[model samples]
Target: MTTTDSTTTSTGSPATAELRVDRLETVLTPTERPVPAGPWTASLVFAWRAILKIKHVPMQLFDVTMFPIMFTVLFTYLFGGAIAGSPREYIQDLLPGILVMTVAMITPYTGMGLNQDIQKGIFDRFRSMPIWGPAALVGALLGDALRYSLAAMITVALGIAIGFRPGGGAVGVLLAVGLLLVFSFSLSWIWTAVGLRMQTPESVMQVSMMILFPLTFASNVFVDPATMPGWVQAFVDVNPITHLTTAARSLAHGIPDTGAIAAVLVASVVLVAVFAPVTMRLYRSER
Candidate 1:
């Protein structure tokens, strides 16, 4: 083992002291290193890393994949008769709402993942590296787009398999899916901020669920909100989830409600605008 040694001495002048150190030396081999990529490139690299993590931890996908299928199938069969006279009729109404709810439900995982990385010191390592500060978060969000897409596809496929046909055709369905993705991406910033603020991943999950459950269930997802009590109906009318579900339902059914689409888009933009800065600030504070 190499070690360093130091010594101190005082001269006759009492105030004068001299210190010397012996430095241990070791030979370092020269190695080629990749240049730092641009912010977008770095973000994409991190995004790829997020995707690759799934290969090692396949269960991470259970929520995105299985939840959609189960929610669609189970709800369609269980309440179809009571709600809409038949499963087929109920699916048309339910699938769109379910799609929105499913993606919304999954957004909290983004925060949970961030909290885990923070706790594991992975985020600290990233902060110390020569990379864009926001790249890690941005990349994770982008990677989550794939998860959202898969969930949406699985839900739609199962719906079709079990007798739900989207009247919106290819274009309408595509539009609805696109809108949902945008909403989910924007909403995730809230969770990311929560993750940064929370002390633990479990706390982040708990807080996110507390907010999401009412937002999803109280809206027009499973039943007609108008049928609820007057006060509850008032809340459902203004709920952002209700607007998103309405927009999705309209587009999926080929009804083309521009108002609902516009509302959802505006809400998404507002969410990103408000939460993104907060999340980034909290992220930097951690360093």
Candidate 2:
């Protein structure tokens, strides 16, 4: 004999005896299918989720808060006099360059975070949702804005404390910080692409360090290009980090280097154009 869900037998397993047919139907066949979120709405939701994560694990801001302090303080005191005559003299230049470096360095962590999510099956769940495809990636990037802003603020405030003064004043500093954020946002797209292609978060970090170390150190970040060997100077001149640091230093000091600013902007555009689509493709290909 066949038994329908409506029929119940108290003599059988207790679990089966208490089964409810209506509850099963309600789940298997909902009254209405939920509407999919709009692209902007979905992206924002993921961004908010990122903030909630930070709320629970406050230490997530460790890199954001600590990097600026160490780079600004350590470099300002240790290498300042040797490089630029005194800590004060060096800080005037060091602060701006360090600000750019600090933010740029943290960009790699974006990839690490993405890789972690992928391993934890978080992205799988995200992909299964009926939301915009890029929402999760874009939202994580949007969340990173807070970290970048915090780094900039801490670097600026600490710089001022140590004798670094922005001749351009508050407005100029704000403008410089805004530009750095824009460039950093574009820079992060490169890492997201790396994150998707790499098998593990550690691998992503290794590649990122290899790329970033050369770019930041070989650039005109710490010292004047004129003092470097001709070949190194040649490379530094074309390095995008150099361009960004030069432009940021100019803006913070109130001079505003238009050519450098233009170069940074162009580089930002190129990075996004090249990497953003690749990241999306990789994100989609993942099973």
Candidate 3:
């Protein structure tokens, strides 16, 4: 008699065999779930990463550090005698303006860094990861706050070294610095928008300078608006930088001018409201 050994066949439906196949399928395929992180926590992580990057690339901070020193010293001495009768007197005015200018000048780097990441595929990778949508930009801005603060400190220190004293004392100086940082943080959103649209980091820098130079020089930063031509004074009257400088100067001198301060605050709000959404949209579409 011929007997066939029992074996499982396709036609043979055994419950144990089905269970084995199900186990095999489970083993063959794996599902990945993204780790959960709160938006603020994610942003802080990105900020920390950015700060660490500065350790490897110290030159990234060169502009914030050296520019403040050079501009503070140069403008204080070069135009001091003519502008304010002496360097000592001029710095009281010039230092506050320089603080604003330095922070404004460095704000573009936030965009440049963002553009570089986009070009390098880092931003693309970030998009793929599970995190808050605005975490990258928010974190970068947070990191830049440190840079702005550093520039402010350097400018004030250099000014003090050269006989520039704030009539407002420490409290007034701190208030001025705080106001500058708030404005600079908002101004960075504009560059962030520009950077998202630009093809290269260099282009972002170029475009930023184009927008910044007029705003910086045409205002009351270097000289009193009263000294400027009538035509220029008209523009200065509307220039947001002039308002910020005026506010900063008043705070530094222990003279509180609520109108100028309110103007700067309003301008900052408008800038962030206008540019922040544009930046986020561009960032989402980058891939």
Please report the candidate that would top lDDT against the real structure: 2
In candidate 1, position 150 carries an lDDT of: 86
Model 3, range 178-272, lDDT digits (tens) per residue?
99888998999999999999999999999999999999999888998897789999999999999999999999989988999999999999999
Q: Write the per-residue lDDT of candidate 1 for residues 193-246, one digit (tens) a residue.
A: 999899899999999999999999999999998689999999998889999999
* Candidate 1 weakest lDDT stretch, 10 residues: 1-10
lDDT of 1: 0.90
- Among the numbered candidates, top TM-score falls to 2
Task: Give the TM-scores of the predictions, in the order they appear.
Answer: 0.88, 0.89, 0.87
The residue-level lDDT of candidate 1 at 30 comes to 52
RMSD of each: 10.9, 7.6, 12.7
Determine which window of 10 residues in candidate 2 has minimal summed lDDT: 1-10
Error of 1 at 29 (Å): 4.2
Each candidate: what lDDT?
A: 0.90, 0.91, 0.90
Question: What is the Cα root-mean-square deviation between model 3 and the actual structure?
Answer: 12.7
Those runs of model 1 whose alpha carbons end farther than 4 Å from true positions after fitting are: 1-35
